[model samples]
Each structure stands twice: as C-alpha cells, then as structure tokens.
Target chain A: MVRSGPYDLNVHCIPESGDTIEEVVAVARRLGYSGIAITNPDSMKQLPFSGNVEGFDILSGVEIRADNASKLHGIVGKYRNKVDIIAVSGGSESINRAAVENPGVDLLVNLNIAQDSGFNHVLAKEASENRVAISFDLGDLIHLKGGSRVQAVTNCRKNLLLIRKYNVPYVLTSNARSCFDMRAPRELAALAALFGMSGEEAMAGLTTIPHSIIARSRPPAGYISEGVQLVYNEADTGNIDEGDR
Target chain B: MKLLPPTLRARTRYLAFEVISQDPVRREDLIRELFSSAGSLLGDVGASECAIRLLAFEGSTGVIRCAHDRTDRTRAVLASISTVKGTRVIIHVLGISGTVRGATIKYLAGVDVFNPKDSHI
Candidate 1:
C-alpha cells in the first residue's frame, strides 16, 4: 500500500503590519496546521517570536517579485539561505530564474502567469534538475478556471500530472488575505479532491509535504522527538490509535 | 425624505457619496452641498436641524449622522445630492446596539480602519 503522509505548508506572514506574530502562531495551532511559511516581501529577518509554535513548526521565508529573469536570478543566488521558500510574487521570468538559480528553495509557482509565459515547461525541468519541490496556487488555479469551478478542477489535475511527471515537489495552501479566510484541514482536503486528488494524496498535500518543506526551511532542535517518533511508528504499523496523542 | 423603515429600528445610518463632476473642485463642492441638503430635510421635519451634523470625511466616502429619526431624510438627501452632481451615492444604514458596538470596538481598537466605504457596517 502506498503511504500518504501529513500536510504541513503555508504562505504569507505580514508582521510589519499590526498583526502580531503570536496571532499567526495561534491561527496555525487552531487549524491543526503542522507548518507555516513566514513570507513577507524582501524581509528575511527572523520573526519577533520563535518560528516554533506550541504544537507546529514555522519556516522562515519570503515572497519576492523581480522585474525580469536576470534580476530574479541575482536575488535567488545571493540570498538563498535567507529564505526557506522563495515564492516569485509574479512574472514568469522571475519564477524561471528562481527555479534555475536557487535550486534548493521550494518554488511556489503561480500557474496563471507561468502558463502564459510558457514557464511551466521550464519550471518542470528545473524541479527535476534541482530536486526542488513545487506547489501551484489555488488563486492561479481559480483564475485559470475563468469562473468555472469544474474547469479549474480539470486544469489542476493536468498540472498535478506535470508535477508528478517531472518529480517536482508540491504542496497546497489557501492564499488567504485574512485570518477568517483560512481553511480547516478537512476543507483543504475537500478542495484537493476537486483537483482529482485521492484522499491520501489530498492528506499529503496538507500534511507530509508541508511538514517536509518546514523541516527543510528551519531545522528545529529536537523536532523528531517522541511525538514525531510515535507518529512514525503508527504509520509503519497501521496502528494509528495513538496518532492524535 | 420618507421615514425610517420599521426594519431599521435603533440603527445608526451612514451616508456615502461619490464625486461625478469632472471639475477638481466639484467633489468638495458636492460634499458641502450634501451637508446643506441634509440640513434642509431636517428643517422640514421641524426637528433640530442643528443635530444633523457632518461627522468626518472617510476617504472618498463621507459620514453624516443625526438621531436615528431622520434616516429617511438622510437617504433622500444623499439621493438628491447624487442627482445634482451626476455622481453615484451609496447609503449604508446599520443597526448599531451594544452588541454591535462592542464587536466594532473590539475589532477596530487596535487595527487601523481603512475607510473602504463598504466596511462601515
């Protein structure tokens, strides 16, 4: 049996605004989120609070927008360690350069603009070359659908195939503007289903992949302690009775 | 101006207006015109027209309030003002009470409230 893992991934954290770092941590805890990507534009400084939440982990990251491929290439090459996830804010050229230059950073590819610039092919190529993971945004997924939810699902399925084919890493995240807009785990799973994801695949998008990204972004001390060991044991033995513990 | 609808009992009403005239000064002129127009409506009812007051200009939207009794007149004045300058008007009538005020105060106390016109409620 193919084992699907937990979902752990998120994007965006605007700390410069009045929003407190604690509030962001609280929201992640309430939602059963395992990972969070702290993304403010060009701001790579550690958040005022520790990235480690009470129950979840945080990945320090940023979403940067460059004017062109060359500029993006320069930024990624220069500050790869400064960010955990390098999301190209917009522009296909920037994304392409990011994929090529900072091969380690997880690429949160916006499918809407990427497809327009024929960057998806290059994105897929780079993912394979660098062993870097990728995730297509639902906003772009929605935009590509052009108001038709069904079409959006079909497009997402095709996009997933490309990810699988290229062996690019992938995850799921709601591009929420406010705390009220964040989705619960079950809701995110349901959304993934619309993209032709199986229950296990959907679960992984929300859990394991996100966890992996967070792990790579920030290596927290004692992260693989007893709790994580217990989880691993449960996965191995199919005795998830203590999974919630 | 008509009377407040029974549905809007005990509600605080906010009047919103947009500038339509191409002239740069016309927008400010229209705002002044609206204040005067509101005064006239209150005068017709024999109520204290002085109570009808301009509160503040919230971005492109304006806020005016009186005791809830003149809601209809407020709406009418806003509509008439729209007609005079060919600008569009949006009237947001909200039911404000202890519960609403508490929620508003709690949510707004720390946050910088961007007067987005639509979020007044």
Candidate 2:
C-alpha cells in the first residue's frame, strides 16, 4: 500500500469570497492533507485553479443530493464526466440504494446524517460491487455534543462495523465547511476510535482508499479502458496541419 | 507526608502540539481553554484526573503534561476545543512522549509558526 498522506475528499461548499478557497487550502496543506476535493452541489464548473499548491493537490468534486432515484440518476449522469468524485448524499433509504446501485456515483457520503443508521447490508454489498467508498465524517462530531454526539458516534460505529464486515471500501473526512473546521490526521484517527475504528483502519480510509479512488477516477490519460490507451501513431497524425496560432 | 511510591504516583505523558490560528496565542489562554474544554467534555471528575499542565509554549507550539493512561482523554479534550476567545484555532497533536524535553525536541524543535517573518497578521 502506498504511504501517501491523507486526503479530505469531501468538503462542503465554501462561499466564493476573497481568497476563501486559499484559506481552506492553506489549512488543509498545513494539517498535512496531501490532496483534497471540494464537493459543492451548486457549482456548475470546477475550480479553474485547482492544481498543485506547495506539494498539495486540490481536486474538484461534485455532490448530488436527490429526492428520488430518477433525479439521482440524472444528476449522476450529468456530473460523472464533469467532476473528479461524484458524491451522492445518502441519508434516506431510497437515496442510499440509488447511490449504491448507480455506477456513476463514486462516493456515498453522509449516509447517517439525517437519520439513524441509514446504511445497511444490502447497500453495503451494492456499494462494494459498484466501487463506491462510504464516508465516515468527523465534522459531524464537532457540530454535535453530549449525548447526541455519543449517539452519532454509536451509529457511525454500527455502520462502520457493517461496512467492514462486508469488506466494502470506506473513506474518512472532516467534512469541513470552512478552513477553521479542518483537523490534523491524528486528531481524526483518535475521534474515529470512538466509533469503533482502529487506528490502522481509520488511516487506510483517510489515505490508501481515497488514494485509490482518486487514482482510478482521475481523467484518464490518452483515455480508454483500464490498461488500454488510445495510441496515436505518428504516421496517421502526420497529415494534420501544424500552425502556431 | 512521605513521598508517594512510584507505583501509586500517576505517570506523565508529554503531548507536543501545534496551534494553528490567525493571531498570536497566549499560553494562559491555552491553559484556560484546556481546563474549560476538559471540564465541559469530560466533566470535573475526568478533568481532575487528566490534570493537563502546560509545560511550555513557544510561538505556536507547546508541550502539555497529561496523565499517561489518560493521554487519549487529554488529546480528545484538546481536539474538542474549536475556538479560543471566538477565534477559530486548531490544536494539532504532533505526538506524545515520556519526557517534556523529548517531546519538545522531537516534534517542536525550533518551531516557527509564530515567527515574526511568518506572521499572518
């Protein structure tokens, strides 16, 4: 397994203010995130300047939250070719199933945000088959406190246990809305322990799995199926006119 | 009273942490936040047991003394602190060591987060 540092691949929309994205980048870079994907549901286009920053990579992602299967499929088809990671907001049972069943959906995140234990065995199996990584968001822990936090953690642990049992890929994130909400990797690992995730397991979600997802989802080079690239033979391309303009 | 035996005395764990904030941070403010967050998150009993003591603060880095077994709880308490005096700040635990000097040198040697040249404000 590659030992690259963690990447927070699911950050909510950050309002386009004066260099606000810069602030978020600085925080994530300082916190040691090697890569991050800003998942905004409203944005029509990716960040034009999302490139390498002080050795950190900024990836563009889209989040599609739909009320029904048809709408979810429509959004997925629309954004699958546009974003790096196509995330589906999975809170209700219907959405969870739709997200897992759809091959265009790359990430199934926040499955338990709105309800108690929104994910299940069937969803887990489908997600595994579709190669959709589940998200274990630590930002929710910060938003809640006391018994509610405890309950949330408990629900997360339950979901994690099922995800692990089925051997489905999972990812960890702060789900930060702003730069201030970002956290260190160790801090996130410790919080994951509260939800029955071992340190190594949590680190894998933060680093290895996300890394694979990014690698697989990256816009293909000379694009084609895995291991097959469209080769442009020099002889066939020689007839094309070359102009500096 | 006689000194407590080694077996009975609580073991110490030094946590080397970095504070990421927009403004210069005061050591006293960190101490107060630690106690407040610890008290609020873990309650009085848990807070007293952890007994977080600020050993050193240089620039935006610091070493804190916490109970050996309670290191997890102390780290958790520190992570719970989101804002210090209404300014958003992140307390990142670099690592834990048995000696304050070890933690200081290992994680925070010549820490320059609050350096005058690097100051954001």
Candidate 3:
C-alpha cells in the first residue's frame, strides 16, 4: 500500500533569462510547495540553502544531458553522498548505461517511447540485477504525438505490473517544467486513472514512492521537526495527511 | 502533418510581450506617453495579427506584448517598424509560462529577425 498527498518530485525553477537564484527561491516559497527538486543541467550552485527555506524540503538534484549515453538522467545529492535516485530523462541506451554504472542509485525511468519496444523489460532486468530501485514518469507518455489517453493509461498499467512482478520500486510525477505547471494530488490521481491505475496506486505514486526516495537520501540527523516525521508516518500507513497525520 | 485542435495547436493567440528601450534620458517621458497614448490605443483596438499591450518602457526601451502563434507573421510585423526614434528596441518572446519562464530575446531596433530551426516556439 502507498500513501497519498501533494507530492511533486520533478520541477524546473531556473529563470528564462536574467533572473537570479534569490528570485527563483522567493517565487518557490510564495507558491506554498512542499518540496522542490532543483534541476540545473550544469551545476547546483544556484539552488537556495535546502535547510533555510520554510514550508518546503529542498532536495539537491541535477539533470545532466549525457551525450556519451545520448540520454538525460537526473542525479540527486552529491556523488560522494550516496545518491538517492537516478531518474531517466527519456533515452534508453544512455539510461541503461547510467543505471548499470551507478550501482547504488535507484532508477526513475521516463516511459517516453512505445511500450512494445521492450525497454520496460530491459529496465526491470537491469534494476533487479543491479539491486537498484526504479520508478516511472507519465508526462512523456502524455506529450507523445498522436498518443491517446487510453494508451497512456494502458502503458502505465503495464509498467506498474512489471514493477510488481519484478519486485522493483516505483514512483509518480508530473515532470513539471515550471512552478505554474504543477498539478494537485487529485489531478495526478486522475491522470493515473487514464493509465489504468487504481486510485490507491496513483496515490502511492504521489506519496509513498517519493517519500521512500527522500528517506533513502536523508542524512543521519533526520529532518527538522515532528511534522516531517508525521507526514512520513502517515505515508507508511497509506493514510491521508489531512490534519497532523 | 495532421492539424491539431485549438487547445493543442500552438497558435498566435497565446503571445505576451515585453519591450525594453535603453535610452535612460528619455525613458520616463517615452514611458508616460507610450502608456497614455499608444498603450491605451492598443488595449482598445487589437491588431489583426496581434493584440499589442504595452508592458513597460524603461530608459530608452519600451516593452510590448505580442502573439507567438505565427513566427513568420510576428517577424513580418516587427520588421515593418523601422525606428524607435532614438531608442533601441528589444523584444522578448516568452515560451513556457509559470514557475519556469522560457523566453527568446530579439533586437527589433535593427536587422531582420530570422527564425532558426532549433528555436523553441
């Protein structure tokens, strides 16, 4: 069973032009976001201090456009600091290579291509073999040209089935490019229904999976307050965080 | 290619504009007149190809909002405007909106605006 809430794992806040990091942070804070995963291709220098921000847990992450593997993969936390997750930014060969090379990192496969293409099987096998966790994003499926909502739902069901069968880990996200593009938890659940996922399964994608990934990356000291713990506690029990969990 | 519906189709209707004029000495005067006159006119009478809305004119630059539906048409309209009197005109075409702002800058003060194949709409 997975928990449910407003869990947004992928968000890009970098400005279009001259806007600075402070401005970006200010905008994010004003939006009342729970967590923000900063994704700058080159470096994480511009990200605000993760601990300082209020009402949000700032996760350190990066989206690298790797040509050697010809794919985009996000590496969260520093290399020396055991990476929590490695999300596939939609490319097969490169993503596979990154997963294989980075033994400890979990895999977040962006199912951007055809389901019949066998990429899912390959990813499952690789994740199991490497003892790495895995998750998938539905944004790519929705964005595909001539792709139908039914097809997207079917693809997600197939992917989730594979995860269950292979005993691999999984998560869900909107793959948002900007702050305004963020979707509410209910919206994500509705999207899951399009992919043949039950309301519970969809809720898990938003809560449990993301919380699990964050748990893996957290330092020994733990988070700032009991409120954070309450969120995770409710998530573990697959309950809603309406009040104080 | 198959034609998409209005919701999915990227058209000229969604364009928003920002114009910057960098002449510091005439900035305030140009802005006041621009807002009171040209800005009001545009707000009242929308163009066929674009609904021009004056954003801000700071220093010698004035910002205006324009449609991004058709690049060719947008460029054509921008090209027809010759002089900004003495101010340099900088046009910024915003791509994706919200938390992430994707914009492409163009100097309409001089030179012909050319669309590159790799440019994002």
In model 2, the clashing pairs are none
Candidate 3 chain A, run of 10 with poorest lDDT: A71-80
Give residue A45's error in model 3 in angstroms. Answer: 6.1
Compose the digit string of candidate 3's lDDT tens values, residues A1-245. 11123445655566422333344344333323356555444344444334435445666554544545422323333442533234444455555556644554544445545444234676776666665545455554333323453455566777777777776666666565543233445444544554456778766766676777666666346456435653355446776657963
For candidate 1, write residues A146-173 as lDDT tens digits.
3353444555677677776776667776
Q: Order of all candidates by lDDT, from best down to worst? A: 2, 1, 3
Off by over 4 Å in 2: A1-3, A16-19, A43-46, A219-223, A226-245, B25-28, B43-49, B114-121
Q: Of 1 and 3, which scores higher on lDDT?
A: 1
TM-score of each: 0.51, 0.86, 0.49
Task: Give the per-prediction TM-score of chain B.
Answer: 0.43, 0.86, 0.33
Candidate 1 segments whose C-alpha is farther than 4 A from its true place: A1-8, A15-19, A43-49, A97-101, A113-119, A139-155, A219-245, B1-121
True contacts kept of 2: 0.33
RMSD of each: 15.4, 5.4, 15.7
Residue A30, candidate 2: Cα error in Å is 1.3
